[model samples]
Target: MFIQSQPADPAIHDKALRIANETLFIIRCLMREEEWGDYLREAYIIARRILEEKP
Candidate 1:
């Protein structure tokens, strides 16, 4: 017999969407600005990876 898969949790989904939306503005800013500090650069990289892997 095969097991069924579960859907994503509503709260978790909402949180993830919110995080993705929030990052868009900053990410766009990062695109225009030439000066990115170490922390911001790291955050941009992580955010890009997350967005790329989305279904």
Candidate 2:
């Protein structure tokens, strides 16, 4: 989702994709256990941070 909003810079785009993918992967793991409330929220916060940090 966030990946689609990335800029044209290959480096920043790649970094955003990687961060989003890793965050989603962790969320998926939590979802498997049906225990992702706080974790998912944290993941979104981190995603926003990733977006802010990108150039």
Off by over 4 Å in 1: 1-6, 30-55
Write model 2 residue lDDT over 10-34, tens digit each, in one string.
Answer: 6655665566667777557547545
Model 2 CA deviation exceeding 4 Å by range = 1-6, 30-55
Candidate 2 yields a Cα-based lDDT of: 0.57
Residues 1-55 of candidate 1 have per-residue lDDT tens digits of 1111433356644554566556655666656444434445455445444544547
Instruction: Report the Cα RMSD per candidate.
Output: 10.6, 6.3
lDDT of each: 0.50, 0.57
The C-alpha TM-scores of every prediction are: 0.40, 0.42
Q: What TM-score, to 2 decimals, does candidate 1 have? A: 0.40
